[model samples]
Target chain A: TQLLEQSPQFLSIQEGENLTVYCNSSSVFSSLQWYRQEPGEGPVLLVTVVTGGEVKKLKRLTFQFGDARKDSSLHITAAQPGDTGLYLCAGDSYGNKLVFGAGTILRVKS
Target chain B: SQTIHQWPATLVQPVGSPLSLECTVEGTSNPNLYWYRQAAGRGLQLLFYSVGIGQISSEVPQNLSASRPQDRQFILSSKKLLLSDSGFYLCAWSPPRKLQETQYFGPGTRLLVL
Candidate 1:
């Protein structure tokens, strides 16, 4: 059973386009993190949002934590081919384990 | 300034064979460690976590077990490998400050059980 759900399991777009991915859950979380993974590498931390209604940005990526702490969103601006990879959002519920969403595989054609 | 490392970037093991994977953390002490498995085309599943030496919390009952013998060391071992164990194993750590901490992951070990 997946604790978190991500929308648009697969996305393909041309360069310069914009897209948004979402992660939703019924349970509340203390903090949420966004990660990007390449073809053969582990997921790299992008940004973290701790407070409800928090928003953080890293370069072309923007992250938002829902006020209720049960959802999050990641938006990419002017997407590039280099951004093609898997995007994952994980939530920490008060322990060592991080519950991850199903992930969104994005493909940007140059 | 913390780093996490996992051994055997890629492994090919036969079924029914014993398996062992090791993870180590540097530049931090008494950190919270975690073990996660990602099947092909699937999301990560938390297997176990540890808060301190000799402390383990398992989230799933599987053929695998984890141990933390040292403050900076965590190990995942299996008495007998199963084909279902073929997946990407990731090791992560976060400071023990809060439950909502952001965990950093290692490069991960890709295990292929034949």
Candidate 2:
């Protein structure tokens, strides 16, 4: 079973458009993280949210951890072509393990 | 500052051939190390993890195995490679004893087993 479920496995948008990707799970996590991966490269950590109902913003990107700690959302404002990549959400399963969602592939056309 | 490295960025092997992929982390000690496989540009499937030397945990049962011979080195090995073993293998590490789980990933090794 997929511990975490991410919506909109693939998305394509025009530059300046806004978009959001979601990660949900029935099990509560100790923490959640967002990562962006370019083709042929390792995924890079974008942000981490630990507390319930915590919201974090990095430039035009926004991340929110659900109040119950079982869900997270990543929103991008005025999306740019440079933002095209695979966006993945991972939940901390403790014991230094993580459960990951299938990830969302976003393509922004300029 | 710590950096993770994976060698032979890409590999192509035949069935029944032996396989070995190495990962090493520099500038850290006693890190929480992990091995993951990614397919179709999607989520990571945790294959194995280790918290210390000579200690390895397998998350999935398969033809592969892992070993940690040194504090900062982790190796994934298989006696006979299978065609199903074709995929991108990734290595990652997190700070020691931190529960928050912010992991840093190394450039992956793409293995194509024929």
Candidate 3:
């Protein structure tokens, strides 16, 4: 089974603090996706990385895919209260199937 | 523009009761549909996925079952509810054109078994 392990299951920081969440796996994936979920809602797609060593940025968020396609990271710069949520990383294994990481719960207090 | 809709934002049912959750997509055709469950403090668990009508793939064998009666509609049902089944259920869809397509998620349904 393909499994993605996420680090720092819970993180709480004050506003303007920076943090990074990591997702690692032994199995290589064809693609990886990052999502942000708030309470009482489904996760929203933050970014998708398909190629090795690829980087994508969305405003204050930065996403990176590992060189072997077996890991990924999400970095938030100057986090605000609005950035508080559960960050998840998912890896595509087969056709339309995704293996998800444990997830990182972030809380940014303003 | 594409959108996905999941019904009954929240539900509280007694144990052993039947359960049914519906999901539908609009503005897209021949999309891949997926059902995922998320427990508190954990990530999503792939429950079921449908590539086409009447084609369902189970990721984990459990009390849950899924069906797709049409190209744009998917349903999750169970004959008996389990207390462990209570969680946030999310429905998602992706256009089947790319190998690594991004999925769009619905508002989701929160089920609580009492």
Candidate 4:
């Protein structure tokens, strides 16, 4: 089974604080995706990384895929209260399946 | 533009009752459909996925089953409800025939079994 291990399962920070969540795996994947989920709602896709060592940014969020294709990270700069949510990392296994991590719950207090 | 819908939005059922959750996609054809379960604001647990109609892949087998009756419709059913089955059920879709791509999720159904 392909597993993506995510760290800092729970995080709490004040507004304007920075945080980084990591997703690691022993198995290589073709692509990695980041998602943010709110309470009582399905997760919303945030970003997808297809290239090794690739870096993509979306406003205050930065996503990076490891060169080995076995890891990824999501960094949030100057986090606000709206940024508080569950951050999930999913890896596209081989063909049609995706392996998901446990996810990181972030709480940014104002 | 693509949209996915799942209903009923929330459910409350007694144990041993039958369960059926429906998911449908619009503005997209021949899309890949997936069913996932989340434990109260936690990570997702993939239950099943379908590449096409009548083709379902089971990831974690138990009492749950899935079916794709049309290109854009997917259903999750169980003969008997379990207390452990209560959670946030999510449905997602992605473009077909892609090696790797992003998936769009629906609003989700919250199920609670007594």
Candidate 5:
């Protein structure tokens, strides 16, 4: 099974602060996705990156796929209280199945 | 305009009890359905997926099993439940014909096994 490792399992920051989360893997993937999950709810897709070195922006959130397609990162600028949630990164591997990282819980304090 | 529904938003059951959770998707056809389990502080684990009626693929061997009885209906069940089964159960769907398509999730069901 493909494994995706996420860094900084937990993060707390004051509002307006910036934060970044990283997802790394040893195996290459066809595509990668980022999701945000609020309490008691299933994760919602934030973005999907298909090409190596691809970058996509969703408002204040910026996502980057590594040049090797083996890693990805998410950066939030001027974080707000609404930005708090559990962030997850998933990789699409053989059979079009997604392998997910453990997840990073982020809290943006007001 | 697609929506996925999972019933019994929260369930509390004693150990060894039979388990049945249902998921149905509306507003689409031939969509890919998936079942996932999320333990505390863990990521979503793919348990099963189906591309069509009566076609199911098991991703991990465990106390849980999944079935697709209709075009857009998926079910997760177990003859007997275990305490370790307590977690958040999620059902997701993606558009057909692509493995890398984006997936939309349901509201989710919280299961607690005592």
Candidate 6:
């Protein structure tokens, strides 16, 4: 079975602070996606990285796919109170199913 | 534009009660549907996926079962509920053969078993 391990299960930071969350795995994936989920809602797709060493940016967030396609990272620059939520990373394996990491709960205090 | 919907936005049930949750996708056909569960502060746990009508795949071995009766409708059910079944259930859809493999999610259903 493939497993995606995420680091820093919980994070609490002041507004304007930057943080980085990492997702690592031993198995390779065809694609990796980042999602942000608010309270009482399903996850919302942030970005998808398909190529090794690919980097995508959305507003104040940046996502990176590792060179081996076995890992990914999400970085938030100057996080605000609006960034408080659960951040999840999912990888599409050979069976066309997404294997997800445990996720990181980020709390940005204003 | 495409949208996914899951009914009974919130549910509270007894431990031995039967379970039924509905999911439907609109504005798309031949799309892939998925069911996932998320415990408090945890990531998504893929329960089932379907590529077409009457086609279902289970990823975990548990009391939970899933079915796709129609092209755009998926259901998750269980004969009896367990305390562990309390969590947020999410339904998602992805366009078939999309290179990015991005999934759009519904508002989700929150299940609480007592």
Give the interface-residue alpha carbon RMSD of model 5.
Answer: 1.7
Q: After superposition, how far is residue B17 of candidate 1 from its true place, in Å?
A: 0.3
Put down candidate 3 lDDT per residue, B1-114, tens digits, no spaces: 898999999999999999999999999988989999989947888898888899898988999999999999999999999999999999999877542457788999999999
Top DockQ prediction, candidate number: 4
Weakest lDDT window of 10 consecutive positions for candidate 5 chain B: B94-103
- In order, the Cα lDDT scores of the candidates are 0.90, 0.93, 0.91, 0.93, 0.93, 0.92
List the candidate 2 regions with Cα displacement exceeding 4 Å.
Answer: A94-96, B98-100
How large a fraction of the reference contact set does each model reproduce? 0.59, 0.71, 0.59, 0.78, 0.65, 0.63
Q: What would the per-residue lDDT of candidate 2 be over residues B10-114, giving only the tens digit for each residue?
A: 999999999999999999989988899999789999899888999898999999999999999999999999999999999999898763488899999999998
What digit string (tens of lDDT, one per residue) describes model 5 on residues A72-109?
99999999999999999999875568889999999999
Where is model 4 chain B poorest over a 10-residue stretch in terms of lDDT? B95-104
Please provide, for model 5 over B1-114, each residue's C-alpha lDDT reduced to its tens digit, 9 standing for 90 to 100: 899999889999999999999999999999999999999856998899888899888988899988898999999999999999999999999999765558899999999999
Please provide the root mean square deviation of candidate 1 (C-alpha atoms, Å). Answer: 1.6
Interface RMSD of 4: 1.5
Candidate 4 residue lDDT tens string, A16-101: 99999999999999899999999988899999999999999999999999999999999999999999999999999777578889
Which residue pairs come into collision in candidate 2?
A: none
- lDDT digits (tens) for residues A52-86 of candidate 6: 99999999999999999999999999999999999
- The CAPRI classification for model 6 reads as medium
Q: Rank the candidates by DockQ, best first.
A: 4, 2, 5, 1, 3, 6
The per-model DockQ list reads 0.62, 0.68, 0.60, 0.73, 0.68, 0.59
By summed lDDT, which 10 consecutive residues of candidate 3 chain B come out lowest?
B94-103
lDDT of 1 by residue, B1-114 (tens): 888999989999999999999999999989989898987755788899888999998998999999999999999999999999999999998887544478888999999999
Proportion of the native interface contacts kept in model 4: 0.78
The true-versus-predicted C-alpha distance at residue A82 of model 4, in Å, is 0.5
Per-residue C-alpha lDDT of model 6 across residues B37-110, encoded as one tens digit per residue: 98885898889988889988888899899999999999999999999999999999988754227788999999
Query: Clash pairs of candidate 5?
Result: none
